[model samples]
Target chain A: MKISARNKLDGEIEAVDLGAVMASIKIKVEDPGVLTALITKESAEGLGLKKGDKVSAIIKSTEIIVGKE
Target chain B: MKISARNKLDGEIEAVDLGAVMASIKIKVEDPGVLTALITKESAEGLGLKKGDKVSAIIKSTEIIVGKE
Candidate 1:
C-alpha cells in the first residue's frame, strides 16, 4: 500500500532488542548510514522482524523537527 | 545541545508554506534528495524559518515505523 510519509528508507535489519513494551530495531542504510527505530513490541512481532530482514524505516513529515545548526 | 533522536538530516530550507494551524516546509538535502516537514505554524514562525535557510530535519527513533515489502 502507498503511504503519505515522505521518508522511506530501505535497509537490512542489523539487530532487534525487545523490551516489555517497546522494541528497538537498527537498520543499516546506504545513504544515511544507519537508522534506529523504536517501535512497539506488538508491531515488531506483527511484522516478524529479525536480523538480516530487509525492511524500510518509514517516517512522516509531521513527525520531523526542523533544527538550525 | 544534543538530542536523543538518531536521525538528524542536514539540509537547506527550500520553501515554507504556513497555514492557520500547521506549516509545510520543504528541505533540500544532499543524500535523500528533498524532504518535506510538517511543522506547526507557531514553530515555523518561532524559528523564523524562510527560504534558503540552512537547517536540519530531526526525527526521533520512536516515531519511525518499520515497513516490509
Candidate 2:
C-alpha cells in the first residue's frame, strides 16, 4: 500500500504480548534496536502475528514530539 | 522521560519543514529507514529542532493496525 507516512521498517517479529484490549508486538529490524508496536488485540489476532514472522512496522503519528537535551 | 509507548528510534534530524500550524521532521535512524514525524509548529519550535540534531522519534498510537499479506 502507498502510505503517506515515510517510515516503514521491514522487521521480523520477535515477541507478541496480547492483553485484554491491547497488544504489543516487538519487531527486530536491521538495526540493534527493537521496535514495539501497540495495536488492538483483535487486529493482532486478525494479522496472525507470531514469532519469526516478517512484518512492516508502519508508524504514522501527528504528535511525534521532537525532543533534544 | 519514561513514556508508556515502547517504540523509540534514535535518529538524526535530516530535514525540518514547518507550516502554519504543523511541521514535518525527517530523521535518519541507524537502520536503512527514514522516520518521519509530524508535530505542531509550536511544539517544533519549542523543541528547537534543526538539521543534524539528535532526537528520538516517539510513536504512541492505540490504533496501530497490523497488516499482513
For every model shown, what is its TM-score relative to the native structure? 0.84, 0.85
* Model 2: native contacts recovered, as a fraction: 0.53
| Count of steric clashes across candidates, in order | 0, 0
TM-score of 2: 0.85
A1-69: candidate 2 lDDT, tens digit per residue: 677754677888899999999888888878646877788888888889999998877766564555666
- Candidate 1 positional error at A50, Å: 2.2
Lowest lDDT block of 10, candidate 1 chain B: B1-10
Best by lDDT: 1
| Model 1 complex DockQ against the native | 0.68
